[model samples]
Target: MTDDQPEEWFRNSSSTAWGFLSAGAAIAIIVIDAATGWHPETTAGGVLFALVAYAAFFRTKVGVSEGDFVLHHLYSTVRFPMAALESVSVGRTLGAYAGGRTFVSGAVGRPLREAVKGAKREHKPLSNHADFVEDRLNGLAQDARDRRGIKRDSDEQFALAEDVRRSWDWPLIGATLVVAVVFAVLLVL
Candidate 1:
């Protein structure tokens, strides 16, 4: 049996673009804060945080390749045979606030789910990262079914994925832009 080692895949263009934009925005914020010279320390921290966050997001690995195709998100790193992959598809309508920062909310799988649930239990509303990761994985499985010419339970999964992708992106972008704009406006004011 051949080893199914993962090859590094290039980051998505859109993801990279967003990363730069966010980094630029963060830098801008820091600069503006510095120019005003009121709260230099706070402004510097904000800039550093944004830049670091941006680096963590797009500069980091978005997907990993194994043999035929690439698996996206951190979950792609999970130990599983290629056979375990059900499908590979881009996640659903992403919420904007999370989009420029990430594809899925957290590292994929059960640990993420537990963290999300834990946050919710603690009254900290969490993003739908795990669900999105699951959706993408299901899509991959569905694609596999299609490719193998196998009639499996992927039909519903595909349909759901379609819905998620369509509904998620715009709102996510909109929300992020809205927040960013609000911050800009506040700064201006």
Candidate 2:
């Protein structure tokens, strides 16, 4: 693939599962409320629950493309060039830091121990998706450094321009915030 092409793009499957489960629960609540008594309060609660489900499921994407690591969320898109990356680490989740900003993968947790056990059982090495992605990103970062003739140094820091700004979806953020405030107020009153 060309430099501009994405190596891969993936959302957190676990988070997607949770989103679907929550949405299903919300629908169940609404159906139960309607069938039993059609209580307005119950209906409102169901709607709020559904909104939370939407927010969780529909808002996050992570990818590597064009020599940059990109993170997309409900309100913003953050990008960091590979050369500027200090490190990429995965624990319960994945994270990369560059230019003094940290970009976290939106996906759910991935346990390293579980992956290692599975790999051993399957007689494979580093066969899990998370490990594969981590390796690819690390390789890309190394390539970027090589291209720039940068050597690994403990004392020197790689920093990008301070003015680098993430693209934001203001309208979506505003709407979500408004809905959240309304939901909170409803609960309070």
Candidate 3:
């Protein structure tokens, strides 16, 4: 095993960019429809929901830390200890079964894959980014058994405010509340 461990995780830059752009586009469409004197209320509701969903998706990330694989979402984070890995699935997305659950990510970012603006995507090296990431992930998982002195993430660190009944997920919940208030005002107006 090498002395160096990965300190950062890979992410899909293109998809991240597109998600934000789509959110902006939704807002624009809503404004345009409102000016047209159409039923903007219904459209506002749908777009607002989409905005919240996109925010959650935007916050998703997968990565490997010393002695563990981390899958992080908007309000929850699960760490599957390397020692508990059952198998690694490689394809359009990467998945793993550990800690009694299956975790998968389709947006494993391949920076080189989207590097050139108009380059053909079939290039050998760029196409293997998935393989590269997969191999790195698996390699660490395999090496985890023999590794020591590696600090695992504390339970507090993983303590994401996920309770929907409470105000834990403030950003998403706040958006929903704001939208509801707007809907109420619109109905009264």
TM-score of each: 0.38, 0.71, 0.58
List candidate 2 stretches off by more than 4 Å: 1-7, 106-108, 112-126, 144-164
Give candidate 3's error at residue 110 in angstroms. Answer: 11
What ranges in model 1 sit over 4 Å off?
Answer: 1-10, 38-41, 48-56, 59-62, 65-79, 91-189
Q: Encode model 1's per-residue lDDT on 1-189: one tens digit a residue.
A: 113434434344455666777778878877787788756455645655574555445534333344222323321222232223434323222211111222342222334345455435322113544444445445544454455554543453233223212112344345445556555665666
Best by lDDT: 2
TM-score of 2: 0.71
lDDT of each: 0.42, 0.66, 0.57
Give me the overall lDDT of model 2: 0.66
**Whole-model lDDT, model 1:** 0.42
Tens digit of lDDT per residue, candidate 2, span 1-189? 124434667676777888889999999999998999886667777877777577667667677667666777656887766566667665567787765666776553366666455435332217666666666676777776666666643223355423244899776667667766776777677
User: Model 3 clash tally?
Assistant: 2
Ranking by lDDT: 2, 3, 1
Using TM-score, rank the candidates from best to worst.
2, 3, 1
